[model samples]
Target: MKAAIATSYGSPDVIHLAEVPMPTPKPTEILVRIHASAVNAADWRLRSANPWFVRLVFGPFKPRRPILGVVFAGEVVGTGVAATKYKKGDKLFGWTSLMKLGGHAEYVALPETGAFAPIPAAMSYTDAAAIPFGFGTAFSFLRKAQVAQGQRVLIYGASGAVGSAAVQLAKTMGAQVTGVCSTRNTELVRSLGADHVLDYTKDDILAKRDLYDVVFETVGKLPFKESLALVKQSGTIITGSEMPTQMLARLFAGKADKQVKVIGGTALSTAADMKHLAQLSAEQAILPVIDQVLPLERIVEAHARAESGRKVGNVVVEMG
Candidate 1:
């Protein structure tokens, strides 16, 4: 098996392609021959040790897991004795738990009961590879906020992966959606079912008097004060990307106002959520937005592209 090995925590240049031993399924696991995978924030964040605290969880000097990838779209090639959920030839897509990241390889073994779901018949591997991170994160946060029909919802970074999914899912839940993005992505956000699109460069979001029932900050760029001001009394603010300082401040925000609720944490990726996302994609209710596709050999380039902050959506890598 071939795999992209992350030698250490540093630049994308640290990742290199090498031949590795194929993975065999454990008693409750299935062996999957990967067809495609995605390069997401998780990949680059772990690779670069961005937050500095990442070193505490991953490693002090180097990464614990050298092959870094979380999202995978592949076919089951074999199953262990206790793995009954899937069989040979079954096409599946989902997240490999952060603790056991190995989606960049040509093959990987995962628990059958993990966040795995069948790929929709109408969807391609590349598209399936793109959904788990963005859509799954958005779905988790939206459900956490308990967004209901007729509620006013605001999403920042509407052109990015999680932001794009948030716009579509919020509309599906019947919320009045307002999306904020760059000028070039205003139309793109509108097409994704956002009721109103605001270009961050031109629009003064803080100046707007209308208060929202929920405000979702996907990029971590929105200030806590601004988020608190945007939400109506007794409303919710969900931050998908929270800096350490923001996380600390949110603890006292609810105490200070006693009217607004602040929510921040890692997104959950469950099998049930993956199944729902697959169904939505099959129905064309939520579409996967891919910025570019590269071969597995060019994973370094893929990492660079994902970290460049210019990609509108996912960067998929095909395993040939």
Candidate 2:
């Protein structure tokens, strides 16, 4: 099996293509032949050991896992005797759990009960590879906040993977969506069903007198205080990306107001969530926006592209 190995945390140069042993499924697991994977913030963040806490959790000096990828789109090549959920030739796509990240390879073995669902026949592997992280995260958070129809919702960093998903999902829930992004992505966000698009470079979001029922900070770049000011009384604010300090601030801020709720934590996905996303994709209700596609051999370039901050949506790597 060929994989992109990251021996130590550092620049994208640290990742290299290498031949690794193929994974075999356990009695309760299934072996998948990966056709495509995606490069997301999780990959680069773990690779660089950013935020410093990644070092303590992953490893002090090096990464615990060498092949860093959380989502994959592939076909089941083999299944253990006890794994009755899927069989050979079944096409599935989903997350590999952060603890067992190994999607950036030719093959992977995971438990049959892991988060996975059948990919629609019309969808391509590259598209399926882009869904789990962005759409899954957005789906979890929006449902957590209970975004309902007729509510006003604002999404910051509306052009990125999670942000793009958030915009569309909010609209699907019938919320009046407002997306904030760079001047270049105004049209893109608008096309995703955002009722209003704010160009961060020129729009004065704070100047608006109207407050929203929900303010979602998808990129962690938006200031907590600013989000606090934007939400209406007793509204919810979903922070998709929050550092340790920001988390503490969120706690204090929530307590201080007593009415405004601040939600921040890891986004979890289940088999049911994957199934819903698959159905939405098949119906063209929530499309995964892709920026570019690269081969597995150019994993380094893929990492660079994902970290470049210029990609509009996802950076997919084909296992060819």
Candidate 3:
């Protein structure tokens, strides 16, 4: 099997194409012939081994997992003895940050019980690959904050994968969505159903006195204290990345001060979320935006593209 293997953790240069042994399924797992896989911020974060703490997981010297991808849309080539939900030849899309994060390979073994669902009738494998990380993360965070209709919600970095998903999900939840991105992305964000779009470069996020019921920071670039103030009394502030100390203090302070929530770990992948996203995709209620698609051999370039933070949505690596 061919794979994008991380020989060492550093620049994207460390990632290279390699001929590797094919992975076999465990008793409760399935061997997937990967059609496509998508990259996430976690991919580059793990590659760079940044923030120092994460290096503990990736290993101080090299990546703990040599293959570096988590979201895949593939066909089940074979299944383990205990696998039941899917049979050989089932086309599926799911996440595998749980089972060693090896989706980058041409073949990967994932637990059948993990976050996966049959690919929708009308969806392509590339689009399905985009769903697991972007849709999954946004779905988890919005559900946690209990986003509701008619509430004013703000999303930072609204053009990126998670932010784009958040925008549409907030709209589905009935919130009046406000998306914050650069001027170049204002229209893109607005198209995702944001009621209002703010170009963070020219517009002041905190200048407006209209408090948001929920503020989602996907970029992790906002100052926690300053950004939290944009929320209305008892409103929530959610972030994909870590929140600073003052924000944690407010979060621990309980619902009295708008119940700030700093989310890090993802929600358990549920069958329901995958089905709902698939249905939405089929109905054209939501669209999976693709930033780039690279061949399996150019994974190093794909990682570099994802690390740039300039990608509008998801980047897919297609297996030839």
Q: Candidate 2 vs candidate 3: which has greater TM-score?
A: 2
Residue-wise C-alpha lDDT for candidate 2, range 50-131, written one tens digit per residue = 8898999899999999999999999999999899999899999999988789999999999999998999889999999999
**TM-score between model 3 and native:** 0.93
List clash counts for every candidate, in order: 0, 0, 2
Clashing pairs in 3: 149-174, 234-258
Tens-digit lDDT string for candidate 3 (78-178): 99998888998899997876438998989999888777888888888988998888888888899988998799989988989899999998998899999
Give the CA lDDT, 0 to 100, for residue 293 in model 2: 95
For each candidate, give its TM-score against the true structure: 0.97, 0.97, 0.93
Alpha carbon lDDT at 51, candidate 3: 62
